[model samples]
Target: MDTPNRLAAAVSPYLLAHARDPVDWHEWGDEAFAAARRRDVPILLSVGYSACHWCHVMARESFSDPATAELINRSFVAVKVDREERPDLDRIYLDAVTALTGRAGWPLTAFLTPSGEPFFGGTYFPREARHGLPAFTAVLAAVSEAWRGRRSEVAAAGAALARRLASPPPTADADPGPDALGAVYRALERDFDPVHGGFGEAPKFPPAAALEFLLRITDASDAPRAAPMVQATLAAMADGGIHDQIGGGFSRYAVDRRWLVPHFEKMLYDNALLGRLYTRAAQVTGDPGVAGVARTTLDYLVDDLGLPDGGFAASEDADSEGEEGRFYVFTWAEFLAASGDAASLAAPVLGAAPEGNFEGRIVLHRARPAEAVARDAGTDSAEVEEAVVAALEGLRALRANRVRPERDDKAVAAWNGLAIRALAESATVLGEPRYLEAAVRAARFALAELRRPDGRLLRSRRAGRGDVPAFCEDYGAVALGLFALFRADGDPAWFDQAGGLVEDMIDLFGDGTDGGFFATGRDAPSLIARPLNLSDHPTPSDNALAAEALLTLAAYTGEARYGERAAAVFRVAGRLFEGAPTAVAHLAGILAVALAPARELAVVGPAGHPTTAALLAVAEESFRPDLFVAWGDGHCDGGIPLLQGRVALEGRPTAYLCRGHTCTGPTMDAAELRRLLTRRFRLSDGERRVGP
Candidate 1:
């Protein structure tokens, strides 16, 4: 019962759990390496994030044991890294581990030389070797003996590993056309689960970025293949247990092929990205189901996760009172007690039998359509839906009284920026002013609390602490959010703030010599090698997003510099697409914008100009990711390529459609504006030039 002495003093909860161990523990930094060199011992590097379940298991079983800790402390300079805090470190090390061992996961246990070159690595070694893997203690003893006695062999192996890690295989770009996009789609199709949505088998993650890429490709080319892939995936996710039926958001992912069992963690980034996708999907397909999911996700943020200052909280833990999925899973008896007659009606449709998905606890799901449930109950579908809602409301109240999962209330600037953008976009699509207001408030809070005195943004703030230096993602994402705010509201100040951040990002994070931006700023901690991860994770990489942000800023501000910067970043990483196209979807979206004709609509008139409103409505209704809309007033600059010299016609609100510097005649009617906007996509370029 005594506090573990090893990591008890550590700030990270995961590290604290191993505090009382016999092993000597060192927080990741220069001090750890210095001590290793002084003691003439090899280094043991452990990498993992806070919410990782197996990471906790490994810590409890091995790191906290006195015998194990003693061995580790004596032979190795044991270091612990919170991967979330230092993803650049994690990236290089993970790549090293994967290369050395041919596999990777967290709590990543890797053996490294004094200079920090990994020679051996694996994930989740048992306290005692079992399951066709070496026991942690035996592996430790063998490695330690080898380090002391077989120094030459260890050094040679370390040298080879270091070389391999240093030199990644080349990604050539011999062909650069739609074929590259086709290659990604082919990969997705190969791994696609036809019965359920998403790629691969069990433990399916929401591929929001990849799906968004497909959606954009389909919309641009009118490709039917991509559309169905997207629709099927979205539909499966919405209907599955991965979606919280009682709550408003999605779990981290489904643990099974059917999307019936989830890992139970709810991440802020997942909800933000998924919300935006659903909103856009609804716009594209006019599917009310997609709209419902989007609305519910936004509501969850506003009602449960929104911070007092307007920024959203980071995550909700998967474990509730030391048990995973405890807050969500329920027994049949518990459901019956809570639902009364409603349970009888819903039970048959939900497959709520005595034996359930997880040891008699049924994770609620809809096995049949609402109409089928309605038919079985001899009621209207609407009535059945209302009854189901009422039952869920009651169940939610009961569940609230039970023990809840610990909420991670840290406000991350990058994630909050994502939430802000999603909210603003959702507000516009769903016609909800409160969502817009929430977005504006969060943006204001971020600007106030997340910014340093010198105007550089901070990455995160928690427990009244607010000085973590912001990375590229924070600056780029917030800038994107600010641009979204500018579009949602006709405020030029938001645009100004966004533009300022873009300048700050370039000044601080730009690799002036090579081109693309670095994940860490010039003043941030130095790693073995500065890495640029363009692949999308739960969120897009900072570099890919930076390109997108720059392109968007260019569209809105009429700044050619922004466009040039975006193009340069894309070109710098152009070769990377040959091997890792999935990571560069954000860049791909930006490229699509570049290849297409840039369309900017300028509505010049009063704030409530009816004609302006009509044109604005038309712009909103149409799903054009590339289109930028702005209201033109005397205070607002009209020199933007699409707005300059665009005068109001006959004292009425007028819209100007401009490509490059040339503008068409001002139109006051919504029909005329739609015609102008759709003309290019509807007709061949040659035909359009001939005025057919």
Candidate 2:
């Protein structure tokens, strides 16, 4: 029988997976650092998340090996961290590794001092020396020797890293303006792959923020190119293997330039961001195909990732049965055998061949259009479409019989927040009440199960238990999600709760002198440094999300201080904007909101009135990141300042529009409301303000 280690008590699924490993692994916390100090040994920080393929690989290759485990246990105080749960450690250590080796990814291998200062690190060393990488044991031996023999050198490295992290980020020469948006857009255009769509070369991520940024671009001069880029990329991804042709969600990323192959792990955050992106794309382009894709992607979340407790899980693993992509792929014969009735019809459209596309198995992609298939088969396009749907249903049922990938059933607060935001927004846009209900349930779950009695939020919930303190990202994201729910259903409670969260975020994560927010909360356990995420790599950075939530709250409540704090975040992120525009894609979106005219829309009407619904529809018809919608019968029941003075005009449903606190007359006409929203106007001289 295998012995369970200290990791057996860990809440992290990743840590639990290694519970039976012979390695003396400690969870990231005071206990691990204390043990390291007591033993006078360097800490071996191994950071990775549940869904990371290489993380799984390294675990199986090294951690599972008794010999390797014995060496690790003897040489260092091994610590395991789930990056999803503790992004502060991930960010700090990832930076340290990147600084040391110029590149980084999971599983992150870092040598830290007892106090948690990272000195030397690299990613995924092999068990045996191969592929230009040294063996894990050899690297361990070298680090151990350096710690014991060359102690001063190790200390110097730690001190240097500490100094670098403690230093303030460089500020921009001037506050960015509308011109900064153009500069970033131009940079994106240069990096764009015209023929294949999306930016740069192979291994394409969803680029959710960048796509949203492009969709939000309303400039007449840039619209032509921007629209095509957004549409083409969306269309390309929908047809690609990366989009889970049999299922309905996307994988982590494509392995090829054309998105023909994927890494196969489906992440909750990716699906959340993509669902919202596609829903908006559908709104912008008025394409039913895009809308259909949005529905499936959003539905995928509730059906597959949703937990029993009303929250969604973090991710689904990439590998099943010890083979990557095994669960998602099928042989051409297997596809044809299971396709049934639509086999011949579906084969042409599904890119199935006797010679498979990926390792003797087919990674299904839409190779041919339904129209083309119908024409060649001497059938109607409608029939072809119907056949394709039937074929997909058959494929789904067949795939269900296979050994499925394991789900990391950890419901992360920040990820659930992202999911809630997507579901709420998509519910309104797609007219799907179920999505709204899901969002509401999720928000309620977070508030009830993940919140402390002291009003602070927890980082995650697993098996109905949560103890990890929430970070800045969690606060920002959950606030944004609740705010979206407020817009969808006009529940002032959600708005008030959202506002309260933003307040807590300010108090807990705000760096008063430096501006912006830290990844960890104020009272959370301290590490070597307070980590800050400046780039939106996997999701919106901590500060970007905070700034967005802050700006949104400010627009609704007329709070000047909220906007001021958001501006400070932009200032803190100025260097990133100047050098790596693409990296700060989400921040650019927030910056656009900051630069544009503040649009506050309030509808005063009786509940369940058609005129009121119509007015709200106009506001939701297009994507306006700057617009904040408030609906009430007459008074601001939730203390939303935007709706305080709003009332039904002439005893009928009325819509009021405000730009920078300057209001236009109320209108009961939906067409007039649309016109008011679409019309461009300059702010008053007194109301005009400079950019963040």
Candidate 3:
């Protein structure tokens, strides 16, 4: 029997995974470092998340082995960290790993001095030497030996890293303008897999933020390129195995370029961000298929991830029954058996090779586009799509009896914030009241449960305790979510809540000297140096989300201070905007929003008035990614600046369209308001496309 370690009391599932490991694993904190100092040994830090598959593989192959565990236990004080729960440690260590190794990925292994400055690290290692990499045991022996015999050199290296992290980063002169957007677009075009529909070759993530950037750049000049990429990527991902045909929502990423064979974890942030992008894309391109995809994803969130009260789970694990992709992949026989009458059409559409695509089983990806399949099956595309939807419904029911993947039920505040914003925004655009209700529930829960009375937001919740104070992303994203809810429902209290959260964020994460938000809060535990997050990885950066929230808040309140605060961030990370900007897509999008002329839309009338409701719906459904909007029914108490002097004209619903705080004459008719909004902004190339 294996002995339990200190992680047995931990809240993180990733840490608890090793609770029974033979190694004397310690949870990350001063206690672990104290032990390292007391023993005069280096610290071995392993960072990963619960949903990470490679982390599981490393645990099974190396950490679980008694011989390898003995070496780790004896030579160094082993510390386990879940990246999701403690992104600060992850950020600091990951940067050190990248600086030392030129690349970074999970199952992050770092050797730190007792004082907690990283000196050496790599990713996964096998128990014995393989793939031209040293064995875990061998690496441990060398690091331990160096710590003892070469103490002066190790201490010097640690001191050097400490200094490097402590130094402030140099600011860039360039602002992200049209020139920067074009450069990033051209780079994406160059790297885009024309055949597969993603930016890179394989291991393809959905590029959610980049797609959003494209959605925002919908001027005539950008549409020609951005439209095609957005459509192809959304279509390919929806048609591929990465999207669960039976269950809704998307897998973490496709392992292949063609969106087949995913890593299998379904993350709340991925679906939330992607749902917003798809709905926006559908509004822009008028693609019903794309809209259907967005709707399906939203429904999945409500059904699968949403907790009974309102908050959402962090992630669904990739592995099931101790095997990767086991719950999702189907045998050829099972696929045909489930299809029955439609087997002839469904078999070809589902890409079921006789020997299977992976591990002797079909991963259920689209073998060909539905249009081509329609041509071959002697039917129209619409009829084929109907048949395919029916077939998938049957398969979904069939798979219900299969062992489901494990779900990590912890509700992290930042991810729920992303979900809330997506759901609330989609509710207005997609005309779904249920989504709005869900968003309200989530926002209310976040404010009530995940926040302290002192106005500090907590990181996560499990069972009942909410202990961890929020990071930068947690504060920014939750505040943005509340802002979106306020916009959708016209509630003054939501606006008030959002404003308070933003002020708290500015107080906690804002860098007074440098003028941008840091990744961790002022109250967060001390590390070697506070990480300044400027890049978006998988999700939007803490800094960029803050910039976006602040910009929107400024527009709503007519506050120049908020806008000025966001501008300071642009000054610091502007070089990244010109160089490799697509990777930092959230920042790039916000910069465009700040630079472009913003339109504040105010509709004034009673909610019970028919004409006002119609005008509001039209404005709500329009593709106005750049618009700051408010709905007022003869009231200035809505708390939006656009509603301050707005009034209904002659007891008729009136629409006020303004730019740079200047409004046009009030219009009563919805059609006239539409025309005014339509005529307000013309494309740079003098070509007009439909929708806002």
Candidate 4:
């Protein structure tokens, strides 16, 4: 009945969830720091995002207690930060935390000096002492006493850690070469669970990046082992409880090795990345089942998480009604109540019983394959597919009536960009206009809501307000999305937007001293040091992705500047090739284009030209991000030289394939176009080389 505390007054849903906690919490900003300085006390910096499950537990057990709050409020200045909102702050602090403790994770509690120097940090602490860990109160008292009694020692230690963070270990150019792919394969083979399919012992993540890398390597080299790894991972993930069997899309991760139980949080990035991966796998293996999962995941995004404004929502929380997995898990009686005889067919496959895995319920999983299910039902595969479809349809409606996870409605520019790329790619593969429409709508939403008057873009928008100057990721992602839109829809405006954004990004984030883009903008607030991370996280880094976007734009528009800029970015990071080649996958895409023949395709005619439509279809259907297409009455003015002056052939639907300013004969036939595209572009032996 009492009024909630400071966090309740905050805008973020994650922060508001901890509003009622007795610990005096202040959102990360100047006020929190000023308070710490005024009290001359150390600060307890807690950094986490809303979707982190352990973060929730720590808040409920420790911060929510009156005693815990009193000690924290009395002894230290407590500041809470949503890492999603301020990634720059998170990066700096996380680096320090990792340096001091040799590990880091969510609900990260670090003791920092008033000036923001971190002394010590760790993850979740219990309300009372348990599991051989000190109690929250005891830890707080000890830290507080140490700060007062040994100020010089603590300061000296913090200073030393700061120096170590300031200068990371010197990296050598250890070009792991193509062998890095082999290394990853060997690593996976060593850790992979034979029965479950994913790597590691338990608490399995989808590891979409690793899977994607493998797919790329396999596709390029014609490696047989690569195909099976892709197949096994996809099959296992599709059949696991980590996937919502009744609905579409997957949960965050599996809590157990067998993929029987999941963490229950569904992220837009995971689904988007996995959707693209599965779609590609389906194409490679010629498996309809894999494609079905991809389609279903896309359906979930459109049906549930799609914003009317066109962007996808950030994530679905893991908890519902204060209980994790309650909304998703179902008991045998509950399953029967939802679907009568339909439940019988799924019961054995899903291991649903009177008592469930977590409580008295069952978390659905496919312990058997679709073929096995068909065999058990004594029916054809097609009949089994129909039955499963009917059962899922019935179950989805019932589940919709129950509680649903909280949706983070904030549309992030970078995440939406990733979703846009996924949707555009899916549109081509599935031949679905709806997906393309979704991609275009999201792109439009971003341009409308996130752009500033001066042409600068913002990082995120929530509840109709856009704040925070766009980071490198924001510019790079939105630009990449726009390029995809241009390819999918053949709108020249998308190309124009992408071009303008790239120019702006180069001006704002480009390292003048070197060449690659910095993570933060020139006008943004200064940190201890600017981090130029190229490693892939849930999404690729801005620098790496920007290179990809630039190369694509160049190929389409025929602007050598774009390609030149991409090369410049690679050269800047070339010195670290051996140390972190995987971080440079985007750069790899660009390099592939450079080494191979560069083709620019243009189809000109009326919007409804049958020939033009066929050529456009061919363009979209191909997995060649290196290729660019344009449809119009005229060629792009600053377009690629290969496409310049080329117009619609014979005033009918016609296509032109150009390489290096040389135009091939125009044709309206799809078969002829396919013949032109099928010709492989080989690299000269001398030209084939890695970056600096």
Candidate 5:
């Protein structure tokens, strides 16, 4: 057996997985760079996450081979980094690769100078030459030769790339107006796959931020394409194979445009974002079917990903038992045996074939809607639904007995924050107390485990150890989550913690002169460049999320500084929003919020009073993205400006609606409050199309 490398003591599961490889792998840090300098060799930086299938493939193909390992060890200082744990480095180098090549992805392989400047890189080199790509060893040999023979050229190239990366992104001081939103809608319409219900072509990822922006479109007439696009995509995904039929969550992305075949890794952030989207969709459409999907998705978070510490896991691996999708797919015989008599009735609806739809196994998807299935089978829709549910339950039970996929049990602060907000909002929207309870527990866990003595958040926690200093995104996301919890349960502690986090976020990551937050904090380890994350990727950018949280805090406290800071962030992000609105959809949505008329609603009543419930229900019934709600009992104390001097009228529950300095209401009647909200929010009465 090969002896373990330096990765044996690492906190990341991705690093630990490579411990027994033949290559002498070093954890990403100054140590590896120093060693490279001493050895007069280039640094081979391998960046990937634990759940990446191609990362695993590259490991087994080359890193595990003794000859290949020997070549790498002799020629370079091999450093392995978990991208999730070190996203700043990943962003810097991935940007380098995209600039050098045309695209980039996981199993990111970059060759850098001893001082840590990326010179050349590409993703996932094959062990041997195949499919028009050079072999991994051949590439390594060539890079080694270039370092030795073409020393001056390599050094110059590295220097040039470093300078390019260190430069700041484009900026526009102009504020985004309604025109920005209109332009984004047009772009999305042009890319919308009307038939398959996604943007662009094959290999579609879920457009979480885009869907969110679409949902916030207030004027349906201005952006007619928004509603149909969101509805079609959500409905398609809910019925597609990418959405696990037996398990209640989504895979990373679909390999095909139709959402039929997924990549199979389940990410916590994806489910959190999608679950919250579906929940909002339910509110907009008033469709029980959409609500059901939301419930199941949120349930999956707690049941499958929830850790013993009340924090959620980062991801579930794509591969299990040495094969990708082995844990998820089933052969015809196995499906039949597990599903029993229901197989005959369920197979057609589930798109299951005797020959199988994927690798001689069935990846369950809804081939037809229940109504259509009932029409074909000569039965009622309810009966068909009942049979399908029963069959799926049986299949789920059977699959539970199989070897489960390895989970990356690290609980990342940013992802956990996403989960916390999703659950908190869903609990109120879906009327599920358990979801609220789960959210509170997760929020508490994050506060207790992922914070320093100074109240700064850590990047992640694994096995009760959190060693990494928090990034801008961590602070932003957690602050947002805590604020959501406060709104859900009216907890003063949550509000206080959230406010402090926002302050820390500004102090640690805010670039005062640049008018935006940096991806890394001031205290974080130095990198080649300090990138400003301003566009939405798999998660919202740090700047966008922080700006959002700041804006919300400003609204509640009536503080000008917070709003000014958010405006500054918008100025920096403006060019990106205008140039590629779809890429910065989250920023666009937040911009919309900033531009929209600010209306504050404060409800004053006892916590469990029926009148208070009625008043709160009326306010929550419709989507009010522009309106901020501050609810409290008559005698509550939290120092919230919005809640100050709010009291029930005539010893009954009351609501106060304010716009800027103008204040109205103190009405005890729920109907009166509904009317006020209806006018303020422009509540729609017809079939809900889109626009929160």
Candidate 6:
């Protein structure tokens, strides 16, 4: 066994992967910076995650090479950072990298001063000069020379970057009104591919957040016109190669606009968001196809991404057997051997080319249906369909024996929170109890394992350790998860737990003088400056999620203070939301909740009553973004303020739809309650998308 480096003592799986390298790597800490200062050299900072393929390439090409390692060890202090573990550091440095290089990505290479300030950086560099870029060793030599010779210039750049990092971020010039959302939709309309369904040209992302935002604004009336975009995109993704045609789950993003061929990595957050997005869309439109996609995504999580301890795994590496897409892609000979009668019929249907598209192999995608393929091949449609199904099952079985993508076993708190919310909400909308149970199981595991006794949420759990203090997203998302659990089963304990988290979050990360919550706690080891990040990065933004947690807690507890704090948060970020509504889509969602003053729907009946389930189903199926639900057994005397004084009408199941502390009317008929919710969706009668 090789001697482990400083990173062996670290918790991040990504960092530990490099602990055996000869680069003399130090984990991101003051100790690394102190070493740089003592050695009188610049700090070589490299930040990447476990699922990143390029990070591995750099490790193999340069960090593992003794010559490169000796050069780095002699001339610079090498620091390796797991971006997932310390997003605060990632955010600050990524901003600087972008400011310096005009672009940024994983395997981020940056030159920092002894004091942890970035002066020059870029994404992946080759070991030697190639592909229009200088080699990594050449870069190290140049930076070292610059540090030694032109020390003043390097120091000036670092100081200037530090100042830029400390400056406040730009906000929206105006309040985020309906016009802001309308503008984003108009832009979406411009970029949406009429042929492929997703926005833009090649390299398409699912746009889950954007799709969900559209779902919310669908029909300031009963019929939402923006639905075609969402429907088209989902259908395109389902039929595309990016979705696992043999297994279940979609990939990270498509490499081509036609949704054929993907980056191959699978992230927990993407699936979670996609599952909830599809499930909610199904509930709104009653589309069985969309519902199926949601089911497939959730099942994939359960079957492929689950951990032994009940927590979900963070991600699956994009590579298997040290080759990217090997397990996922198939060759022509292999396909023919695997599928006999179905080979000819399925080949073209699965978009297999004669010459092959990906490194002499085909990346499978269902470009056409079995029926279509049968027509082209002059075969029976029924037989072709059956054959295709059989072939898929056989392929899946054959692939099972192949080495699988490395699973990152770390259960990240923020990502888990996203998972729990997805599962719980999908359970309600899909009427699937198993999904709800999965949500509860994850929530319990996160709370019990990732939470500190002092009420701090840890970032990730790996090999029975919960070390890193929770960031802003952890608090926001986990609290939201607990709130979802409470609503799903009407448990006061979950609500109380969520409420406690909200209070602690406020104490730790709140900005009393400013409006939005900071990205780190007050007690957090100081970076150059505390970042108040509001932009979305695949998942919802911290400020947006924070607003959601507080606003929801306010609705449940009927506390104006929590609501006021959320309002304060909005005051600061209004312009940012208004200008780039798509980037802050979740904030737009939460803001709608706040402006609607949020409706409270209380269903009171016996837990086991059949009538209760009927009403609950109605509540679940209805798309009420501005409303929160409280289910009870006619006993609302506990911690849930929204449930207080709500009772079944004449012992029959009843629903009370309240706005501020007052119920509009009590109804025993589920149909009547559904009608009331439908009315809330109408745009006429002065009904705004949110509040009037």
Q: List the candidate numbers ranked by TM-score, top first.
A: 5, 2, 6, 3, 1, 4
TM-scores of all candidate predictions against the true structure: 0.91, 0.97, 0.96, 0.91, 0.97, 0.96
Model 4 TM: 0.91
**Which pairs clash in the backbone of model 6?**
172-575, 172-576, 219-224, 220-683
Best by TM-score: 5
Per-residue accuracy of model 3 over 450-493 as CA lDDT, tens digit each? 87777678899877764777899998899899888877888878
Worst 10 residues of 2 by lDDT: 683-692
> Which runs in model 5 stand beyond 4 Å of their true positions?
681-692
Ranking by lDDT: 2, 5, 3, 6, 1, 4
**Which runs in model 3 stand beyond 4 Å of their true positions?**
1-3, 220-223, 377-387, 680-692
TM-score winner between candidates 1 and 3: 3
Ten residues in a row with the worst lDDT in model 1?
683-692
Question: When superposed on Cα atoms, how far off is each prediction in RMSD?
Answer: 3.5, 2.3, 2.6, 3.1, 2.6, 2.2
Give candidate 1's root-mean-square deviation (CA, Å): 3.5
Question: Residue by residue across 1-692, what tens digits does model 2's lDDT show?
Answer: 18899999999898999899999999987888889999999999999988889999998899999899988999899999999988888888898889889999899999998988888999999989999999999999999999999888888889899878766677676667666676667777888888778899988998998888788774434445778889999999999999988779999999889988999999999999999999999999899999999999999999999999999999999999999999988887778777878888887788888898989898889989989999999998898888777878877888999899999999999999999999999999999999999999999999998888888899998987779899999999999999999999998999989999999999999999878898888897666778878789789999889999999998998879999999888888887776888888888878877887789998888779999999999999888777899898875556888888777888899988997666798899999989888775443443223221
Model 2 Cα shift for residue 161 (angstroms): 1.7
lDDT of 6 by residue, 545-660 (tens): 89989989887778899988887777777766556656776676666556554678888888889888888888888677778888888866456888887777788988888877
Off by over 4 Å in 1: 1-24, 167-175, 220-222, 376-379, 638-651, 681-692
lDDT of 4 at 101: 78
